[model samples]
Target chain A: MDAIFKDFGKAYAEFDGYNLAKTLAPVAPEAQPDRLYNFHRSTNFSSVQKDFKSKILHNNALPFKLTSEESNGWVEVYCAYWKAVGEILNAEAATKTHNKVSWGKVYEAWKEMTVVLIRGYTNSGFQAWTVPCLYVAGKYMRVFAIKADEDAANNPSSAINFQDDFNPEAEKNEKLEDAARQLNRMFQICLSDRAPLEESRKWGIYNIINLLFKTYFKLGSVSLSKNILKALQAYRGDMPPLDNFPLSHQVTFKYYVGVICFLEENYVEAEKHLTEAWHLCHKDAVRNKELILTYLIPCHLLTTHTLPTLALLSPYPRLQDLFLPLSRCIKKGDLSGFDAALIAGEDEFVKRRIYLTLERGRDIALRNLLRKVFIAGGVEEAKEPNAPPVRRTRIPVAEFGAAISIGSKETMDNDEVECLLANMIYKLVLFGAFGLRRRIYRLHMKVCLAQPYPPPIRRDFSGGTTSRT
Target chain B: MSAAPQSGSAPTTNATSSDKNADPAKDTKPAAALEEDDEFEDFPVENWTQDDTEVPGDNTHLWEESWDDDDTSEDFSAQLKEELKKVEASKKR
Candidate 1:
């Protein structure tokens, strides 16, 4: 215990934030036999305090000495850390004994620790290093809050009084909500830092923002993520280039931003961000890579009429099952097959908030079918003498109607087929030129003669002719 | 091309033809198993460059042109011919 304080004191005096964080973190269960945190075994706050004071503050034999001012801040932070660890110990004991109340106590203790740690951000020499400490405090605070909330829901009689005055309107998950608010305070502290780049609290920005993103996403309050992005954008000029940040920060930031754009139907921007995240992502991060590809693959399908190859999907079996059927259906221009695949993956896609985007692939299938129809038309001699013959691009509407009926589950009347054709023409004009000339379908060869039909460009399907740029 | 509205009259034939032609089992699997850990976490690595990526080169091998040029193969061509013959026969009727 004395050596633990000595090392902590040395790190503190040297302004080594990273080591301070390591020292401050609660000892993991597997490391219980280690003497450094053997004090944790005592499970009493005052006794630990007695040890901290006698071992470091009152002992003149210690190599590092703290001034009175530094001693005051150190004592305060130490007390907060000890209280949090004590509550955690209590929570663990409670878990063994199935005591619900101790979870709430743990949450409250960590909440207090977060508040105390925020003060270090304003301390001149300690500002830069406070981030790691705050991260630990904030993360566990949320974790325990979630546990507390679950306990409250499961055993309402033991619900902790989260506020001084109870309001009848207190919503469920109030504990988690309060934890989010505390995290927001930490976010603000980092954002408002006016210090120079070297020791600025601004360095903590992405880490805090990432935490907020996780929270917002879990709460299903996706719109709130946009506010964080707005705030970051407002501070962009003052902040360092994102590329200069840590890779974890960069990848996490881009993933959230990409998913946000994806939800907003901004496939182009979403693809750009998600692709960067995927490319720069760590090789061993299989789960994260799968998550990135979860959104990235749909964005790829929409923005560029492309599907992930079997090799890409092979590594991720979940992605393979979710995407392979859809890609095969689209490639074959099999409308009924596409519908079946979409319906089969509907639940997972909807859970990922991508059902609507994947639903748009039906248009591509229809376009491919139309492309095949044009090819089947073969070539026709030009009416004018000496003019090179052109691929037969003009055909009756019934030909398309037949292909449509052949691809779909039910045979459609001419009217329904025409409506489907008109809709496809409006959405996919760039794929091939189609004109309904007196009930005859004219597939214009001029726009793409060599490649008679290209992939359709992404367009807005929400009741407007305005194409997506 | 058949001008007759055969599709409207023989709905069963069209339905069965599409069902036989569009086999959905070639590459697909059962619905994907639910994802276990959906939440994103910070990567273990704080910083890395392209050297650290799983795949070394440009990701050309990962994505391919979606259009299948061989779509005009025997089966699809045969199906198209049958459908066109149906249209022409109906028009003559």
Candidate 2:
């Protein structure tokens, strides 16, 4: 115990954050015999407090003596750390025995520990290093909150009473929501710090933001994630460049920002962020890469009217299954096949919140079919010698109707086919040319004659013109 | 077409297309069955350099510019011929 205090005192005096965090962290059950194991076993709070005071405060070997105020902060933090650890161990033992009631105790202990740690954040020379300790406390607070919520939901008596005072606006996971509030306080602390960069709490901002991102996403409150981004944007100049942060922080920030843009249907911005995340992401992180690609592939299809090649998807079998058939049908201009593929992957697409975006790919398929029609209309011969031969731009409406009927299941009347053409023109899948009333669909001469006719499919579902070529 | 499938409510043309190829088993399965496996994972190491990532270069091989293949025009033209013939026959009937 004396040695443990000696090490803690040494780390605290030197502001050695990593080592300080080590002292606070609970020992794993599998760790071999060590002096730290004795600290872990010291479940009596009063005795532990006695040892901390006698060994750490009085010991002359620490090289520097802590001020009374500093020693008070340390005493509080040290005692709270062990108290939370003890409750966590109790909770684990209870979990082994399927004792659900003890979970709330773990959450309470961690909540208190987090408060103590937050107070400790204001202590001079401890602000930067103690961020990890706050993270651990907040993380477990949310975890145990979830466990407690699940236990309450599963318990019959609790469920029976849950309906009595249930308000639709009330949080279903009260404890978890409280954890988010506490995390927000930490976020505020980090953001409001005006200290020099070397010792500023600002360094902790992304870590807290990442934790908030996880919490809000788990709570299905994605809009709150936007608030975090907006706050970061407000402080953009004060904050360090994203690249200066750890790779983990950069990759995680980009990935979440990308997904948020994705959910908002901002495909272009989403593509930019998700692509950066993909490039910066660790090569060994196959799952993270796959996740980035999950949103990225759809963004690519929507923004650039492109498809992922088999080689691009070979590494991710699940994505291949989700996207391959859809890509194939779009390329072939097979309307029925596209519809079938969409239906088959509907659940997965909706789960990913990308069903609407992928639905727009049908326009691309129709555009390809229309492109084939223009290509089949080979160039008409030039009337005079030395004149350029003009590519055919005008085709009988019946030709398009024929193509549509062949691609779909049933034959359509001319009026129905014309309506479909009108929709395609509006979508910019087929560049609108005048003469629909005459039953001859005149394609835009320049657009249709371009090598890849009808231009790339540019769809703007936001009711804006698809002016992007 | 007389047998128009269900018309969708959205402005985008949800033409009543045939579902002969759609697998009922696939459609009927609950959405939750397709578990989201690509969740964000914590990094094993807190920091690394660009060297730890994939060597960035041309990304063209992954994305194809145009959906068309070499044989697409020929196949489409031949199919259009057959379909135009069918349309002509239907008009005559």
Candidate 3:
């Protein structure tokens, strides 16, 4: 058995994983008096090899065999080896790398051993739960990303941060994030099916998406902006639909998406998504809502074709100076400045969005229940009779603002809150909240009329709404 | 010809073609079953379908016969003994 195995490896080392596969056709030692019955001589080697190769090309990660049957186990093992092959492929893809094979071919041979394991210890392999090699192979992908980033950081032409219209290279980065996000989809499917072993393997794959987003944003790259929204949809599907996520997650998600929309120049949609996120954002969470809202002002003003009055700029004092240059850019439609702003601050804005999405999803249910108690007029048990006159005051202005921002923390009952929300949604229905947009419109109109020159009608839903939806 | 097997996601032309190959109970090309082709797809070479019987490198380096009497082969034992003595000598010296 040892000699035959060694002979097989020696014979197959030169051919890439596929050519070596052709050798399977001749492994019928069974017809001879001397044969090792350690493998299945069933399927044609070419078909098996081709199937294994295809899955690896699509995803660097492959599922380990965990089924009760031999046929399924073979399929899983084949997928694992193909993924290892993907690693070598990925490394070959790096520029300035040398072509060749060496001691590293041992990994490829280990994949071949899966054939023996399935034929020899099919049930025991499943029982022993041997890990598939895809785990090792997938690490090469992260290594690829880090290497590419390091290269780009040192290159002069790579100065463009984030996916601006100027940076054609950003498209490839977007594809990488898309690939990572796909892992989350597979993980949820495994979790839902109650396959713990399979699910654990997929965990790293999905987490890479999160890590990738963090990495790209940290470098001021806007590559994850679009893909993260898609990932949010994936996360949204994992949790129940339409419930408030954790307040914190909602805040961050809203802020980042808002920033992306601002960068993308879809001001109306950006503002809507960001506003919805803000309205639902938590109080205890960091003031990303404020930051996102600061950017949102530019989004709104640009879209509405109105100038920010000195009075209106009072709320966001930190932004007054930065706002002027952007205002000039917006006035002239200087896209470069907007791109620069996004590229310069892409990380902080994007991080805020991710943090908000998780926070929103996590606390949506809790916030709704908490809001119920507040709406039901439940108060902190009457402060022990005579605790400083009970403060007998109306809601603080800040608390009122907080209550409005945290959509679930209102004094209104569920029905009233629902009614207000519906009114906002059905603006055409002539509901009171629906009329609120008309006021936002009138204010914009007035501001435009007062200005010497105006660009166009700016919609409030400019940035946030467009980015998320 | 077809949609390139969804770039690794779906069974593409390769899989479809292989489906047309020999028996299911005993595969003729088992090495293809362990395909690393998808991994090294651009290796400037591909699987040896009947259409591609002529491989690039010298295929004459036969190793199949080496296994005929490999069980009693003294090469591995002698190499192991030499390796052990080297380590033992290094420790003593």
Candidate 4:
């Protein structure tokens, strides 16, 4: 393979795009592949031969049976595909769309061209020059995906989010999945090749992974994102140290992992990754920074019972809008107030998908309420003279009811108050003891009151008022 | 959005007053002032769905592929380790 590539490299050395600064100039978007198809294939043979060089090294793992003629033909196809890539990237970046190339059309062309490349390369390995080209193309997938999202958001016809209706992105997924698979194929080839990836080539892998992550996220298939992370981890020693990676990869990886941990209620791990993401995130990328803090703040509240201060939240008004009321309620130990704050921000939190995590912040409210109850209870007298005067740790259900009822408009029943306490205990927001003197649980309510709450007590359904209902 | 910190507990209600005012219906009007909290209890926590966070950017979402914006960023791996250690220490006692 090397010998063939060496020969190919010699014949086309001067024509390689790397050396031809002139070719970097944007081609008129109108003079795209559609126009190229009308030209005689033989007319550009000399120029094609000049341009199709072996700057891209081949992978030895999947060698192809190619005569010189066949190799030259593949080179022409690869060059044509890359040419299309450059044209689209350039046009996409232009401030004004002079000859606005339909991204859908460009994406379609990318798919057709990449299918041929994948089949050929799976049988015979890839060239290193193709790596960056493939990476940039993968990056362009975001543009296409965003365009699809925008179209959905804008078109009132597509705006309705119907549960029973078929997904509008079904066709979009077919295109996105094809693009993602092609990118993954190139990435896998880069990974499994006999030689280690060069420092310059490693960015291609990260770019490919990040692109795939975004595509999966948009598809709402986070399991695929999990698979990508697992695959990347398997190549840990083979790849560069994570610190040496581009910042985009670092932030994206941590953000995904942090969010996944948060969804799973692993607040400890979530806080770790999210804090790293927050610190390393670009200061000026205000939106991205806010996104990081969105999850990070919730993780902090759940794990440490600390709320974002006014100073910390001042700069990001959106965050302040989202968190200010909730923080106030948590600080004040107001269950109803916390619930109110959550209600006020439900739409925003649901839109951001942090509602579940923030919902868990009620545990913080419960903790505060229990703490207040303990303080308000003061010192309970010992039943026996020998018994030590204990701090009012033994809280009656009635006291909890009174405390909870203060901020709540309705009078809560004893059973409802007990259920709330039970939930608090179950969620580990409050810890205490259990002293049940009787097996007859119907009479145990009074006995349980003097004792710290314990789990596994059969709930009384006779009250017909348990809040758990 | 209102920056008022009036959510905190008012200490004017001493133990004696609270005992005297144990009638929940009599005190209900004060709680009614916060009608937002009333609706808050209806939020369905157990049924809340976990979905993906959106990719951040404003309208006209053109961006470059290279992540060079964070050139002077701190070492996140070290910071993560430091944070994890702190959490572990707190958990121990």
Model 2 regions lying over 4 Å from their true place: A1-16, A26-38, A98-101, A123-125, A156-159, A162-165, A168-171, A376-392, A406-410, A432-434, A437-469, B1-39, B73-81, B91-93
Model 3 C-alpha lDDT per residue in residues A446-468, reported as the tens digit of each score: 01111122233323433312111
In order, how many clashes per candidate? 5, 0, 68, 6
Task: In angstroms, give how far residue A339 of model 3 lies from its true place.
Answer: 17
Off by over 4 Å in 4: A1-101, A112-130, A145-169, A197-203, A378-394, A434-469, B1-93
Rank list by lDDT: 2, 1, 4, 3
Local distance difference test, each candidate: 0.70, 0.71, 0.36, 0.54
TM-score of chain A of each: 0.84, 0.84, 0.30, 0.68
lDDT score of residue A331 within candidate 4: 58
lDDT digits (tens) for residues A1-469 of candidate 4: 2322443344345333222211211121122322222222322445644544443423233233445544654665456565555444433423122343344555555555555555544554444444544544455444454443344345434355567866765654565666667667867865665554552345456656766666666667767877777887887777877666656567666777887777778889988998776655655556667777888888877676567766567779999899888876665566788898898899999877789888887776666655655554457799899998867654455555656665567867867877776676555454543334335332222222222223444444354222322
Task: List, in the given order, the native-contact fraction of each candidate.
Answer: 0.60, 0.63, 0.01, 0.00
> What shift in Å separates residue B67 of candidate 2 from its native position after superposition?
2.5
Q: For model 1, what fraction of the real interface contacts is kept?
A: 0.60
Highest DockQ scorer: 2
- True contacts reproduced, candidate 2: 0.63
**Model 2, range A409-432, lDDT digits (tens) per residue?**
787776776677768676655764
